[model samples]
Target: MFDSRHIQTFAEVVRTGSYAATARDLGYTQPAISQQMKALERAAGTPLFVRAGRGLRLTDAGQVLARHATGILSTIATAHGQLKAITRLESGRVRVCAFPAANATLLPATVARVAAAHPGTRVELLEEEPPDSLRALREGRCDLALAFSTGHGGEATDADGDSDSDSEGGLIELPLLDDPLMVLLPAGHALAGSSRVELGELERERWIAGCRHCRGHFVAACAEAGFAPDIAFATDENLAVQELVAAGAGIALVPGMTLPLLRHTGLVARPLAPAVGRRVSAFVLEGHETAPVTALLLRTLSEAAADMERAASGSPRPEA
Candidate 1:
C-alpha cells in the first residue's frame, strides 16, 4: 500500500527536480525528503528517479507514477476535507424515518433546528409507523427511526413481527419521551368536559382505532380495564380519527404528540385516567449511533422532545 505522506513528498520532489528544494518548500529536512522517496520507490517496486546533468529527472516508471500522483494527491485531499466536514457537522446527510404523529410535531421542529445549526447538513424525512420504521433501520434504509412502543417490555414489534427487546435485533434504542394517549370524544359528549377519562369509561362507546400496533395496544389496555372495545373504524391517519370522533362515529385514543395537529372544533381530548401512553424512541442499527450525522440528529431530537415536554407541562390541555 502506498503511504499518502510518501506520495506527497514524491510529488513535491517530482515538481522541483531537487531534493533540497523539495525539502525546503515542504519545511522538511533534505534527508527526510530522500527517505520518503526511497519508501515510495520501494512501494512502487521501481526506480522513480535517475541522474541528470545537474539535477534529478524522472525515469519512465517515475514519469508514469508522477502522471498519476496528481490525481492520487487530489483524491486524498478531497477525502480529508470531506471527513473533516462530516466530523464538524458542516456537511452530511441524515435519513430519518418517523411515525406520522412525530412527523407532525417533533420531526418538523427537529428538522428546522438541524438546518439552522448546520446549514450544510441535509435531513431526509420518511414517515412510517414503528414496525416499518424499525424495519427500515435494520435494512439500512434509514439512518435513524423515530418509533413508539407500549411502555411494557418487549412490546415493540419489528419488521418480521419479532419483539424488539433492548439488545435484540441488533438495534440501539434511545428513549425520547413517553407520549400519553388521550381519549378523543365528541364535543357534545357528557364526559367531554372532564379533565381526565378512564379507559373503562370509553369501553362501552364505539372506538375508532389507529394503526395495527396502536389498535393492539388499545385493545390490551381495554382488556386490562376488563372490557373489549367495539372498534367501529380503524385508520392510521390522525386527521381521519379526529374527524370520525368529531362526527360521532366513535371515540379514539391518540398520542399526546398528535394533539397539536388535531384541531377539530367538535372534538375534545382528555388524558387517560391511568396515563396510558407509548414510549417514543430513536432507533439506529448497532454501531450507527456514533456516526456524526446520526449523532447530531439524535441530539436535536432529544432537545425537541424536551421542548415538547416543557410546553406540555405549561398547558396540559389540548385545545379543540
Candidate 2:
C-alpha cells in the first residue's frame, strides 16, 4: 500500500508546481521530496511527472492521482476534524489564513475571544491574499480563510441572491460584510473637501496604489469612471499608502476596514460616488463546518464582524 504521506507530498507537488516549494511547505529536504516521488512512482509503476522548462508538470497518470489524492486528503481531514470535535474543542489547532486588513482589524478580536474561551485550542495565523488563501484552503494547508472579492461580478452570492454563502465547489463561504472603497486625499488637496468623489474627477491627480492586484483594482475602478489613474507610488502597506497621501505624494483608494486603524489624521477619506467595494467572507471546506472548534471560531468571527459594522455606523465620518 502506498503511504498516505507520499500521496500527500505528490498532491503538494502538483499544487505548488515545484519540488523545492513542496519541500519548503512540508518541511522536508528537496532530496527527501525526490525520494518520496520516486517511491510513489515505484508503487504506481509509472512516471508521474515531467520536466517542463524550469518547473515540473504532472503527467496524465499524475493528474489522475492528484484528483484522487485531493478527495482522499479532504476525507481524511474531515475524519480528523470530526474525531477532534469529540473532545468538545478541548484541544486541537485551527490554521487560519487571512488578508492584511482582516488580520489587522477583524481577526485579532475574534482570535482573542477564541483564546480566552478555549485556551487549550490553538489558533495559528497565516497572512495571505485572497487568492492565495483560497488556494491554501483547497490544498489543506489551512482550515479556514478570511477572503474578499471586489468588482460588480466578483461579489460572493448564493443562488437566492440574498446571502453571501456560496455553497458550491465543495466549499462554504460565510459572508461577513461589505467594505466600501473610499477615496483618500491630503487635507489641503483640491477635492479633499468633497463629501464624495468620483474616480473621473481624480484622473489628473497622482495616485498611490497597493500591490499589483490592488493597483489593478484602482485602475479598473478609474476605467469604469472613464479615466485611468496616474499611479505614482506602489506599496503593499496600507499605512504607507496613507503616509504617502498625508505627505502630499498622491491620493489613494482604501477599504473601510482600514479606516479604524489609521494613526494619521492629515488625510481625508470620502466615500466613492459609485460605491465600489469588496465582500468579506469566511471560507471553509464544506464538511468541516460543523466541527466544534471551527464552529466556535466562526461564531466569534461573525460576532466580531457585527460589532465592527456597528462601530463603523456610530463613528464620526472622516472629514477634510
Candidate 3:
C-alpha cells in the first residue's frame, strides 16, 4: 500500500524534475529513488511519469497526487504539534463530573489550582451524584469523575449496574480524602454542647436522612452503634436538611466537606464518636490514569482536598 515515504519521495521528484536530482537533494542513492517511484506507481495503478527528452514529465495522475500530498502532510504536521503541546500540558481540555457537595467545595478550589498552574489548559465541570457521574465517565462523556463511597469497601457501580473494577478493565478509583461525617443538631439540643456525640446517644432523636446511599450508610452506622434511627424526614439537599434540623424537625449526619457551604445559624455540628465518614475519590479509565492533563488534574485535586482538611481543622468548631 502507498504511504507517506512514497508520497514524500514523489513530491521531491516532482519538485526537482528528475530522480537523480531528487536523490541528491534528499541524501538517497538515485537507484533507491527510482525504486521508490516504481513502488509508488505500482500502488497508484498508473504510470506517473514519462520520458521527455533528457528529463521526466508528470502524467495527469501524478499531478493529482502532487496536489493532494501537500495538504495531507500539512494535516499530519499540525496533528503532531498539537499532540506535543498536550503532552507538555501547554494546552488541552479536561471534562470533570462531580457530585453537588464536591461541586460546592472541593471543585472550585481544584479548578482554580489547575487554571493557575496551567493557564493554557481548561477544565469543564458537571454536577452529578456518584452512580450517575460514574456512568458519565464509563460512557466516555467525561474525562474524569469525582465520586464518594461510605467506606463500604467493594466495587462501586453505575446507574446501569456496571462495576468499576480495574481488574476487569473498567476504571481506577483513587482515594482523595476521608471526609469525616458529623452529627447535625439543633441549637437548643441537650447534646449540642458536646465535642463529640455517640450514635447510641441519638437513638431516640428523630433523624433527617440524606440521599439513598447516605441513608444506607447512616443506617449501617446506627446498626453498628446498636440502635435504629427514627428517620422522620429524608432529603438530599444539604441546606434543606440543616433547615429542618434548625426547625426542630429532626437531626442529620453530614460530611465535613459540605459544612462550610451549608448554613449553621440555628444548628450545631459535632464529630461522631465512632468517626463515621465517606471516602472521596477520583475515577478514570484504567489506561488513561497517566494522560498528562488527567494526571495533573488528579494531583491538583489531591492538593485541594488537603487544603480542605487543613481549613476544616483550623476554622472555628461548628457551634450554635
lDDT of each: 0.82, 0.82, 0.82
Sorting all predicted structures by TM-score, with the top scorer first, yields 2, 1, 3
lDDT of 2 by residue, 53-115 (tens): 989988999888987998888778856654543443335778888989999999999989989
**Candidate 3, run of 10 with poorest lDDT:** 153-162
TM-score of 2: 0.71
* Number of backbone clashes in candidate 1: 0
**Residue-by-residue lDDT tens digits, candidate 1, 1-320:** 99998988888888898999998999999998888888888999999998897689899999999999998987777456434434433348777888878888999999999899888888988988778887766655667888877854446545222334446667777878889989988999999899988888776799899988888888888988999999999998888888898888989988888878878888888999988988888887666678788888889999889889878778553443
Q: Candidate 2: minimum summed lDDT over ten consecutive residues — where?
A: 152-161
**lDDT (Cα) of model 3:** 0.82
Each prediction's TM-score versus the true structure: 0.67, 0.71, 0.66
Which parts of model 3 are misplaced by more than 4 Å? 1-91, 153-165, 315-320
Candidate 3 backbone clash number = 0
For residue 108, what is the lDDT in candidate 1?
A: 90
lDDT of 3 by residue, 104-182 (tens): 9999998888888889788989988778887677656677888887755332334222344545536887778889999
List pairs with backbone clashes in candidate 1. Answer: none
